[model samples]
Target chain A: MPYHFYNTISQLRQNEELVLYDRVLHFSEEDEQLVKDFLKIEYETESLNYPFTPPSCNAAAALWGAKTVYTACQLILYRENKEAELPLLLPVYNNEMDAAAILSADLCLRFLPQALQQTKNIDPDDALIAVLENHLQQWHYSGIGYVLNAATVNFDTVFANECMQQLYIDRVIQKKDMQRAMLPLLQKKITAAMGIYSATFWKELNSDKTHE
Target chain B: MAEDTSNHLVYWMQLDLVHKDYLAQIRHWDNLKIAADEQSIWVKDFTTSQLESIVLKSIPFTHLYYCKDNLLFPKSSLLPVGKQPAFLWTPIERALPVTLQGFNHNFFGIQQQQALRLAPIEEEQKVTVLLATVQDAGNYILNAPSIRLQQLKWIFINNKDALIIGEPVLPVNGRSYWQKGRFIFPVGYAFEFTVLEKIAAQQIDSTGTHLIWWIDEASYCLLHPDVLQPLSIASWRQTISNSPHKI
Candidate 1:
């Protein structure tokens, strides 16, 4: 067999096992109902008033679950406001928050060290990681199950879902390491797609943060 | 054949004598060493040295530009809406260097008909600027009397005024063909409607009716041959008219 064929075979085996494992792990009556409702709305071919599907709903769910695990592991992470309530998170799964997440992740990777080097009072990296975890949880609750379920039915849907899953894994792992390791790959892909590379938007909570 | 030196001259005459072997290499090496030695040397000096033996780039054609807020309707073809006052440009194609420079120098000499007052075109989005056939223009340039030559570029009208301003850059998405060293005034019905709407908005004043200036940085004046002769005369005339108008 050709090298590529073996590589592909191994990848396919891993993916199938992943899908089975995810189904076993995330499946529940509540998740199934939410997925069914979202799918009905999303797959409605003839509806004139369909709500906008958020960007990468499936990917958001995987991130959400992963982040919940991370937060529970970290112990210091906690819900500080009612804003952490799940409703606010649905928008993130809707792609409304994707750009913000991407930008935050980009900035944290870029400026956090410089910020730490200059001042000891703040660890923006921890805050950034917390935000990422929150968004991941939102995605887990919002729409990842629908996408994974849809994947079993449509190959294209599955491909898109799997690609985002791979990207999430890649980005999260790279985030844990450093942007220098992963940003170029993300930038190359994004630039290929959009002709522009952009970081996430950070909403400053306080006006008095010292300028870099 | 006699060379025509009436327009701007971009010629290829003599740049082939530079030594292209060891001398060029040694010069390049020397320059590299000097540049590395001092980073503060001005870029202009560097360019002057780099281009010391380069051949001049040739222009494909010489063009004459006539700009006005309103161009008159030629005496013959008068549509009711077209009869309105408008500024029109006439490009004299393939102008000789002397004539081109002459017109550039003496634009005011060109006589204006009662209907054809020269004014800057304003907000001329998609206006119909004129184009005359070379044969028709040639006859005017070569055969028209001096007074007529001075008035070579004129707008004529039967019932209404003749002058319209610049056309708007059309709401477009693609790269403009005009961007590629070409003229880009609107033409036909769309052109006429744009000119009409813009002219209807002009505020007349004592000096003359004001016109919109659609001067683009990388724009060329495209002229017809007939328009060129008069434009040169008019340009000279304008200078004369403006220079401390003899008491």
Candidate 2:
């Protein structure tokens, strides 16, 4: 009952997701270096204090890493199964703060996989949602989907329903909107599964903002 | 009437004559003394033999005609038969006299008047009276010695009427003809003909006629009228027809 454990620690430690995501995003050498340096710092610091724990060691780092991974996977999925899914998750932010918060979240998400590998016993899904909720209170309303995406093992009905309820209570999502967004993935109408998490995450955020 | 088989290309330009009174005013008027001013005056100094030597040596033509302005002349033609003129004039002493005594007519006086009278009457007078054949005319004029004249009017005859040719005017600074720069022909052949102009002994303000003989498309000479003679057009036709070679 570790919440939605899909990848083993060894697989997460490989950082393959992050590497492929960097390639997909066409990150410049400097940007890649920056992200790598940030992750290495976060991991080294977090590992020094909590030698056995990963997801629980640095909530900020894990969340940033998870968002980054989720964004990359979403873009990949959008490229593959764009015709079926709702067109959400575009890089449009409300302002500079929103853009920066999203960037920070992506960086946190980028570190999550490796963090997950290091942690001994922590529900990654619960830990990630907690970090995203914490960031949501402080930062502008963006990047919530990426955090949730990193927490869930895949974009399944249970995870989507839970994410929809949480966002609704937080005033980040509108009522009666969860099914239209989650149906494509539930019915297997969405050809690509990689981006399902972030896609649902952003769609819920947009729905909340529309109702507000 | 007959097909002109000569490979030579010729065009004639009428030579303007200085008035008889104007010729009298300039006492020492000679071919070498003629400047660029009086170029229209007829030159009557060249002898038939001198003209022949210059024409034959410089130009490759067999015969040259010295005809009158009144004669019914055929349009100038370049027949597709003969060889290009290849003769080169040998350099001679530069102090030769302009007038040669071998002529049988008072060519300068009568012909000058005829040219003057014809000047207003006919369009032919306005055209350049040139007798050209496909020959190396440049070599002859450039290498031949300078000929001195008292007046620019020099003429020759082929039995019926007078034919006129004159020398180009000398540069004003009394510079030797050799110092006056070289003349280049259109045929890309260049020689120092001005070196033959006798400038040291005589200096006059009179400009004489500047005659151009195009030996070929590219080769031609801007010479004094003394360098060429006008042959009878009829005789030229007869000679070409009679010759074994079509030139």
Candidate 3:
């Protein structure tokens, strides 16, 4: 029902504001576990050692995350000329984006990169691109290796949590993503972590010492 | 500016992805055309290496300059990833530092007069850097006094891009060394953090040149960097010159 609701909202099939999952028992136990399964895998890949513990799936988080992804995918793929209403449909998320919130939302948000790619393929000039791109940056754990707009990435929220920062760095190394790795915030820490043997670990870290 | 022979700048001319071809097998590689291993293949004379071009074309590779007295340097760790480049003239399009006479970057391997001779990075493979902690009293190797004379030699020899003066001072503590791969300094004792290099004495200015400039890589900033691995500018640059110019 939540998936249907979000997808309908994006397709102009519905225009309702999102609802929280707290105090709502609309989904089954199996569904909650299934959603948590997605976050678990992404956490492992990211080296997030925060100990994925019991009741990992928060109901409100699952709904918000699923809603965001389902609506985003539909809008990205189908909302061609419907550019003006993008912000209205997928408004900036002003939620408390702590580690728990982000981890919880990754349940369905992880598919964001694939959806974004599909939309880009359909119509690169799609208005929905920016809308979802902003969301992808927020839900970046799922977007690992997806090559988001690295320059615009604000590390304020990421650095707020110790565990998330570590996970972020690990994923960057796991992918050997040079673009994100070279960011000033990450560069210093990663440089110190790898130390003088930087070349031995990641040769791709070299800069193009040439001049224009 | 002084030049370092060990390291070199790599200019990339990306291959079209539409074309289906793998790197050609290596048949011959020399110091002038050093293909020590597949990681990097330094070509001194880009013109005569017609045969080498065949292998190069198939595989992704970067090349360095053949400058004065084999002093090849000016490392580039600043290129963006993920775009293919169109190089009309890969080497000439950019300037080498005045040290080598025509690179945009002012970081010449030379300073005043002390020139540097770089050794090959293809050092003894599989040797890890030793890490030891030194305690002051008994020379427990915790970053001081305990590291024996031998282990210190191994790390300095391997990682010193710049040359060191004389031998390392033995730790004041008793003989001790750890086997982990960390480059911890032997604190407690006075140690100089000089990078290793064969400094060439000089009096020429390494800078203040009316260097030419252009958007050398603006057109290719989006180029993918997978094939570009310039040699480790891992060597050190020290101006032992009486009057060294700022590089």
Candidate 4:
């Protein structure tokens, strides 16, 4: 069977062999259209603020998605740190993100957190940890579940896009990243959004901790 | 506390000042009732024993939200007596993006009326009680309820600017509907209530359907299409001086 990006990741997630990433893999025409439709629909369904702008053409977007998953999985399973080569393989994303990029990357990124957790359990200091973290900072939406350096985010770029900022806050809340929730700007937005229902909505969140 | 002799449901308020809101229930008056009293809320012993001994103030709706003291009728609905009242467990139909006027206190009835405007209700929903209908909402950007009588619990929990029906921040279990570039919970009554930031409302009511905004019988307001505001008693009489819309 032709390699499906999610299925490939699922295999890796189950500790299956790393055989698929080696092939010159490509999704069929039907799969590319499916990827495009999913990203478009999800952007509208999860309205953050701004409108969705496709990152590139349909094929390019799908390819980037496949590449992101393969690379993240390899980084998790392989012994060598693939840090230097990641940028060349999946060029550093532009400062402003497209709905396509975030959603496409998300197919794997959402699952990446749990997979990485297993690695941490086995080897906390594994070289793969640092490599995957760099990948996360580049794709901070996925990093919602991972603890990465927030300072490394391109806020100026993200804030420029209302959709990105809203989605970021949403993902943060979705992930329940206490560290990010404590950010001054984000705390205000989250508080205002929750209004009087903080007790019912996000009960565990302690606003006082942000001050310290 | 007096023993119950009527089938009418009784409710009490519990305040959680830390959250600036409270819950309602069917329990006996406790410290929370004492707190409610400090806010000038009147409570009744509710029994055949003292019904005539007290001064029974006139209220617009009785048995609907029965509370007694020496003076003042209830102005708000009570919360669930248990997790919710049995009647609230029964759901009915309501249209969403509807504006709703609710009782102010957690469960205690206050004198002043509190109205809350909810938005983007695109269609009908199954809720708990019918409360009261606006009859004429006057203008439409909105919708009301056969509301679950128990939503009285959240009468005061303004959690998120826009409610996600019942979803929390994490959408892992959320069933929000995707419409016009935003996510919405089709139902206002949720497992509990979850919230999100408000999104742009669906364009104004094109159908001119008669939408409702539930108002408790504690007080009443009629909307006049001419000025798009709630008509007071005098104004209601003036508008209907010539029209048959008057009761």
Candidate 5:
């Protein structure tokens, strides 16, 4: 599995560079002229389509990069620990949102609110841990499983399958209590993302106006 | 005296075992054990709810059955019985794809009472596949062009019933589409090929054949002949993106 991951990443890196080269080489005279004009701008500007280093980036980032990070982290951790085998990095089993939610609610009640006043909604100390627990280190293995099974086999499919599998297992264990606690937070994030996407979309559509 | 104490301890154990939250109730037995040893007595307060709850949770796949709404869960289909419509009361965790082979094979629906009937037999037949984003086509309804559009719209038709001499175009969630319900097709959908060839040899008929697909989930249909779904194109496009492909 590690070898497969390594090969896939290398192939993806090569493919990304090749695609950008191809696009730049194959552009028509008009597109070439547009590129030249854009280059005249002193500030760095990204191509609307294939701008970033590897060129294109999207949801697949969650699938590929996230999974890669997850697998690599496990391997490195095992090596450092000098363990005979890698630990099944099933984070959700222990540190799911339900556990966090209960802990956070309890903490909020236990600790004085004034102590957290200098920080954002949640205390800075608590926030750092939450970000690590919920976002980065949480359930990477499980998310990958869900993506692989459910989504079309692509860059992100593995992550999607793994994620879903973890969610399913977690759902079984925690039942409705988990969903009830997490839904509001998930909904808020989703809504915020939608807003950003639509705004960017509309801005791109009227990009000609910016030039005018 | 020892025999009497053992019998009394058994009675408390029995009461704890019968409770809804039997595990929590059973924990009380530790206290009972202490009390019995110290006082030369046995006692317990076991609630029926605790034991019953424990029993309910103990059953494997109990929640899965609850999720499936007591539907017969088949691991694999041996007999290719004509497409049976059964609602998945709860959505599956995994994503299902829309592909030529899938159109020939898979069926999906919500867990509800819908009709399954025989398809019309025709010596030569075409299977129509409709591919669209969730935004474009809300839900696709297929019927021969000969059928009145207005009446077809008004009347309810089972998927199999409409697909006479035809296979249903399995709705796969396209990549761009949000993963939500059974109807959301995330992958760009594909219909079956005109010529069915042996899987290994991969031979195709020389003569041209086509299946009409209603694109963008509209009433309109485009006829495709001998062409594999253009998934490679979308993939090549994504290749330009920095992200590595997982699928």
Candidate 6:
């Protein structure tokens, strides 16, 4: 699985060099110039859909690079924003080149605080807590999907409780309006996630514990 | 002298004659002298003169019959046959896979009704035999049509301080019959020639294909090739054959 980071700034910085190479190698002179022009012009929530073949398109490279740099500057400017509202409200950035990396990092960072708290509260008798701690540390360093997959596959009571708690916290924090329609949908997702985690976990548990 | 309660003296004499004849026929087969060791001492008590008088004057009992393995005994010798057999044959010490084919149905009720189709036995493999007889039960008398021996059973025997593993249930059938009662045998155990059911003569379906490994008496596991594969004699055939004479 591809590594993802919780920190958007770190991801943007890492992708900067690759984005630069893509522009130089793949972009035609005309498209490159067009990308440069597009970067200079900005609008407030305007439909800024840049037409370019992602990764190979000069315009796409320029737009992604520009967005990364722009976002980094915005993070700095909004660093003092007590609620971090501007960063949270930023447009959902999905481009093929770094989509997985960005999303995974975001999820890791989003859950890291609760995961750490939950780990602290974990029972000493639980063997799986240590594993979760190690995975959490790896998530911080590797900024990847491995932690999620590992937790999912080797789910124990402690890890599952932590995941559920994290989900509840996320739901409460994200959905302040509390629409009645979305409640059941969110509950269903939570149920489905736990069901899958339990199934995989039990299967591994039974096979591993076999006497023969 | 202990009185023959059933007045089976003539019957016993007749059986003794059959025993002598059977012994003569298989004398060469007893290379290890096991039959000599196991023969009943009662055979010696009856004299030729006594036998001649009984043969001339006495009528044989209806249930009396000579069974395989040189055994001559009354069929109704034991009453209330539901209990486990009292007489158990000592497990053959140096058992070979080839010899087991002949002695597969060593147990009385286990009739080899059908030909056993098994994988070719490798020379190295050895098969062991363990037999038990109900003390009073006569030959061919059974309490139930079928008896369940084990359930979800895994057997391990230490041989030469090394563990010999045996899965009684065939693995494929075992998947579905995991919790369901299934008959399993030890490793290198013969699958065919062992009767899972002993129905009455009228109930027997002679024309139907009889599978040694069973689903039921009429419906057998042979119909499902997967179920028969593991229990197949070839699966247990090994390269090293144990000599019966060694023991």
Error of 6 at A97 (Å): 24
User: DockQ scores for all the models shown?
Assistant: 0.00, 0.00, 0.01, 0.01, 0.01, 0.02
- The native-contact fractions of the candidates, in order shown, are 0.00, 0.00, 0.00, 0.00, 0.00, 0.00
Please write out the lDDT profile of model 6 over residues B1-247, one tens digit for every residue.
Answer: 4545354432322223334333232223222122122333122223234434534234332123222233444544533223221232221222111232455545786564654322222233322211112111111111100111111112111211111112221212111211111331222332343343233211334434432232222333222222322111111111112322221
TM-score of decoy 3: 0.36
Write model 5 residue lDDT over B1-247, tens digit each, in one string. 1233332211122122223233332333322221222212212232334324564346333211111222322323233223322322211111111234445334565465522112222343232323334222222212111111111111001211111111223333322211111122222432233222222112222223433323233332223332332221122233323234221
Task: Give the lDDT of residue B78 in candidate 5.
Answer: 34
TM-score of chain A of each: 0.21, 0.22, 0.65, 0.66, 0.20, 0.21
Q: Which segments of candidate 4 are over 4 A away from where they belong? A: A4-62, A74-91, A94-100, A210-212, B1-247
Task: In model 6, state the lDDT of residue A164.
Answer: 29
Per-prediction interface RMSD?
A: 32.2, 55.9, 16.9, 15.9, 19.3, 30.0
RMSD of 4: 24.7
* CAPRI level of candidate 5: incorrect
Give lDDT per model, in order.
Answer: 0.28, 0.31, 0.43, 0.42, 0.26, 0.29
Tens digit of lDDT per residue, candidate 3, span B1-247?
Answer: 3444355334323223332122223323322222222233233333334323655555653432323333333223333443322223223212111235577586775665532222223222322222222123112221121112222322112121111111233323332221111121221211122242111111121222211111121110111122222211111111111113322
Model number with the top lDDT:
3
State which candidate, 2 or 6, has the greater TM-score.
6
Name the docking class for model 1: incorrect
Best prediction by DockQ: 6
lDDT of 4 at A95: 42
Residue-by-residue lDDT tens digits, candidate 6, A1-67: 1112112323433343211212111234555454344433321111111111111123343344444
Error of 2 at B161 (Å): 91
lDDT of 2 by residue, B81-184 (tens): 23322222221222222466797765566544111010011111121122223122222222211221111232222222222222332111111111122221
Ignoring the other chain, what TM-score does chain B have in each prediction?
A: 0.16, 0.16, 0.15, 0.16, 0.15, 0.13
Best by TM-score: 4
Alpha-carbon runs more than 4 Å astray in model 5 = A1-212, B1-166, B170-247
